[model samples]
Target: MNNQEQNMKFMQIAMKHLPEGKKILDDKGIELNMDDLQPMLELLLNVMSEAYELGKEESMENKS
Candidate 1:
C-alpha cells in the first residue's frame, strides 16, 4: 500500500486502543477512576514515551 494508506491503517489501529487506556494503566500499576479515563490515558502516554526511548537506545547500542 501507499504511504497514506499505511498511515491511515496505523492510525486506526492506534485509535482502537483509546478505550483501553484505563486498562493499560491498570496493568502498569496506575490506579484511576473508571468514570474518567484521561488519567489512565496520560499514564499510557508516559509509558509509551519511556518504551520508545528505550527502544531507540537499544537500536543505537546495536548499531555501535
Candidate 2:
C-alpha cells in the first residue's frame, strides 16, 4: 500500500529465498576465503536485481 508496507512485503518475500550465511561455503572440495565474498555478492546482486524488478513490475499492476 504505502512505502513502508511495500518494503516490508519485499523483505518478507526475499528472506524466504535468501541463502543461509554458512551456505556460501557448501562445496566440500572447494574452499573460499574473504576474497570470495565479493564475487559471490556480485552474482547475487545480478539475480536479485532481476527478481526485484520483476516484482516491482507485478506490483505496478496492482497499484493501477
Candidate 3:
C-alpha cells in the first residue's frame, strides 16, 4: 500500500459513489443535466469554501 496505490483505491471508491450521489440528488428532485451541473457545482464549491474558512477561523481562535 504505497501512496500511489492508496490514492488509486480512494479514487476508485469515490468514482463508484459519484453515481449513487447523483441518484440521491435526482430522487430529491435535483437535475443532473449539463445546464444544471455548473450551478450545482458552484453552489457546492461556495459552501465548501465557506466551511473551510469557518474551520480555519475556529482553529485560530482555539490557538489564542
Candidate 4:
C-alpha cells in the first residue's frame, strides 16, 4: 500500500484502541483538564508512535 493508505489504516486501528486508553486513565482517577489536554495528547502520540514502530518491527520479524 501507499503511504496515505498506510496512515489511514494506522489511524483506523488506533481509533479503535483509544477508548481503552481513556479507560485506563479513568480507572486511575486521572481527570482530563482542558488546560493540560494538549500536552497530554502530545505525550500520548509520542509514546504511541514509538510503540507502533516497535510493533511493526516485531511483526516484520515474525514474517521472516
TM-scores for the candidates: 0.53, 0.52, 0.58, 0.50
Off by over 4 Å in 3: 1-17, 26-31
**lDDT of candidate 2 over 1-64, digit per residue (tens):** 7656755665555455545543645644456654765565556656756687799999999999
Provide the overall lDDT of each model, using Cα atoms, as 2-decimal numbers. Answer: 0.65, 0.61, 0.66, 0.69
TM-score of 2: 0.52
For candidate 4, the TM-score is 0.50
Q: Which residue runs of candidate 2 sit more than 4 Å off their true CA positions?
A: 1-27
Please report, as a residue range, the 10-residue window in candidate 3 with the lowest summed lDDT. 6-15
Candidate 4 residue-wise lDDT, 1-64, digit = tens = 6656755665666667767877887899986754555565556556766787899899999999
Most lDDT-accurate candidate: 4
lDDT of 3 by residue, 1-64 (tens): 5546644554555555567778898999987875666565556555655665698899999999
lDDT of residue 21 for candidate 2: 42
RMSD of 1: 6.9
Point out the higher-scoring one by TM-score: 1 or 4. Answer: 1
Return the lDDT, model 3, position 47: 60
Ranking of all candidate structures by their TM-score, best first: 3, 1, 2, 4
Residues 1-64, candidate 1: write the lDDT tens digits.
6546644554555558765765777899987775576454556555655676698899999999
